[model samples]
Target: MSSNLLEQLRKMTVVVADTGDIQAIAQFKPQDATTNPSLITAAAQMPEYQEIVDQTLLKAKSDLGAGASQEDILTRAFDRLAVAFGLKILEIIPGRVSTEVDARLSYDTEGTIKKAHELIAQYEAAGIAKERILIKIASTWEGIRAAEVLEKEGIHCNLTLLFGIHQAIACAEAGITLISPFVGRILDWYKKDTGRDSYPAAEDPGVLSVTKIYNYYKKFGYKTEVMGASFRNIGEITELAGCDLLTISPQLLTELQGSTTELPRKLDPAKATAMTIEKIAVDKASYDKMHASDRMASEKLDEGIKGFTKALETLEQLLAERLKKLEEKAAVGV
Candidate 1:
């Protein structure tokens, strides 16, 4: 059953492991893998990953000098962690690893662009090719614009935290390499308000959101890839089975591995092309209008941005403590 399901779905979609633990990712043999601030933070706490974090901080201290300021050490250490994770992920997956930039830079076009390049440079320095890296950025209008510049330079991007058609349409217009709509996150917000467990896959609000984005891209011949992400359960995954890609967490990956159900293509570009989709673009005014039009998108965008920012701060704090310890050790001869 596993072999049959793999055969059926392998052609229609790219399977990516959404994890920071390289061991779990290796077990599933996903084509790609992704990591964000939260995953990195969680992984750093694992005893198995203590060496990875310590080594990263030690590298930061050496590169920045033992007396480097905490701010400098923290900034470089974050990069170290991301690169270390990306390198490990690349070793297990045949395709790219999506490493996220600091989410605090979502509204800062120049900062986002600079960090994206820094991430790509880190990968290259680690002996990974640029073609195998996809810098993940929050899908703010600023982020989309930043990605446009990066894409022109041959750096592909994975636009994440995307929750609305407006964001998707703008990303398509910007010619992004990929867009990751949060399927379960969308369903979560809706469920909180409506108090429901399930919806028909086709009519599920979250499902419809991704389907709309997919159809719009297909109808307009946009090359931007649609990768459904942030799923709450297997149902959402099954609902969007034919997405260009799906980044599943380790727990979900394990569930899929254990299940013997038939894997089918639920989202097809050919079928999408048969549906009517309005051609759209987001000029400055329209972007503002859409932001206002979708209350949930606006609120969630800010909330998600804040959540990632807080996590980044926590990670930075952790790196600083480690850096201080390493500095003391170098002085006293550990």
Candidate 2:
């Protein structure tokens, strides 16, 4: 059999599975895995994960007491479910697992920090160390600040929903452990706004955005890792062959594993340093201005947050229905 693109990509970059499905993680055997509300919700519907959902619901009912409100039970259940999935993922991958905070808390720095601590606490309670987990937060200004605080406390963070250089720079400056600069979402915005059918990987705006962020990070000697995320195609993945990491979906992973095409290294720190790009600093005003000026970045950031929020709400609704059923079953027995 010929060599696969995924095996080739692994030679230079860390491959992270971007699904909450444990079976897919096992199939791909990625170095690390990341889970969000959407993924977790989707996986929860599968029969294989229902036991986890049921157990989490039972525990929430017991811990929250009979008088606890439905919202209280659901909030605790979701936390437990997220960590439960992370724990299962940890058993499969030797590397870290990223568990996200609620998207609704993206703009609240203190809320985000509190939630991060809560997640870490849950993982710790389950015998997982802080080093084995990455608290995924949205890359809003507040989220970056929350990550800064979390980093100081020895909690590593993966900043997501990043679309602009301002967000990347702020995240790097905050000493975040990693930043997931979305590639496909950027391309989606550009294609919609410009009415273009498609662009080659080299000129793809999403690819360019990630390459720029990767170069900037390397040029400045920042230790923050740039993880290219939200890939729409194998071309985008191959174009970013030498990124610090790439969190790819299972579908794309399958496509890559089947392809025998040569994957060349497209990003190098040495080459980036030799380039004539000027260094720019971003403060609050400049950060806001730069983010505001980029219509794609601003619109997509908001849209991404809202999309995740909707998925989270759906997950909550599912849990509420399950919890209601469990309560009813118990009542019948009583």
Candidate 3:
């Protein structure tokens, strides 16, 4: 009798905590939790998580041996940091934890593939089965190709930064495990492009975009699960009640926990199946053409990569400084 919107929503869709904050995951108790460079960087700065971050850095140094370069150590530490946080988060949530590959490798197919292998290896080494983890990669063409390879190897991938039907169709055709469509980011692009301040929830650009993608996937019977992510508000969440999954932020999770709204399911696969939606084939050439035309998708995808790359750079600098401090303190003891 006391269930809130979150409780009601969970009945129809899997809820994933879109955060790296372990405390938030523990509090929300979402089925899954996800992390990216930006989220992990924010979490690393928190005092409570200092021990975890330090341990990851120290372990990376120990594994790489004394002859490793600072850059090598930083790379190793950054990779380990993601799994370190994933391990901590998996301890609290019962479902999978998504860890992102380096954003800098978004356009490098081989680099992305290699990084994915290393990440899976690290997780497997930690005694965690690959089923409990999802390696997140950007939805660039190269990234998708890399995911296609990883999926065949029994390594699942969550394609992120997806904004257009072209990207969604490409991911689906590639047989990716899941795809993350950025609802809020799509809305952000539309608002800026049109110079509009608001949109009715039903007409919201992002909402409509995700609805279209969900319907298409169902109509065509693609198995790649759709997870609407990067939500700007609860309206977006409530509007996508029946999506396969919805990763929500702690702030919005708090709001949903506070209100006992009667949340209704808006996306029905049966209805989508009955609708007449034409399918689109997305190969490299068509993907390029469609991506070029959809200003929102192209711009947002590029911006998202740049933003995440900047965050990773900042995190590396943070680790380098922390490692320096550790070395200085150790020298003092000697």
Cα deviation in Å at residue 320, candidate 1?
2.3
- RMSD of candidate 2 to the truth, in angstroms, is 1.1
State residue 62's C-alpha deviation in candidate 1, in Å.
1.6
The 10 consecutive residues of candidate 2 with the worst lDDT sum are 271-280
Per-candidate TM equals 0.95, 0.98, 0.98
Off by more than 4 A, model 2:
none
Computed on alpha carbons, the lDDT of every model, listed in order, comes to 0.86, 0.94, 0.94
RMSD, every candidate, angstroms: 1.6, 1.1, 1.0
Candidate order by TM-score, decreasing, is 3, 2, 1
Cα lDDT tens digits, model 2, 1-334, are 6688999999999999999999999999999999999999999999888889999999987998979988988889998999999999999999999999999999999999999999999999989999999999999999999999999999999999999999999999889999999999999998998999899999999999999999998988899999999999999999999999999999999999999988889998888888777788887888999999988889999999999999989999999898788778888995
Please state the error at residue 251 of candidate 1 in Å. Answer: 0.9
lDDT of 1 at 167: 92
- lDDT by residue (87-184, candidate 1, tens digit) is 98898889999999899889999999999888888888878899999999999889999999999999999999999998998999898999999887
lDDT assessment of candidate 1: 0.86
Write the number of the candidate with greater TM-score, choosing between 1 and 2.
2
Candidate 3: tens digits of C-alpha lDDT, residues 1-334: 7789999999999999999999999999999988899999999999999998888888889999999999999999999999999999988988899999999999999999999999989999989999999999999999999999999999999999999999999999999999999999999988898999988888889999999999999999999999999999999899999999999999999998888969888999999999998878778999999999998999999999999999999999999999998888888994
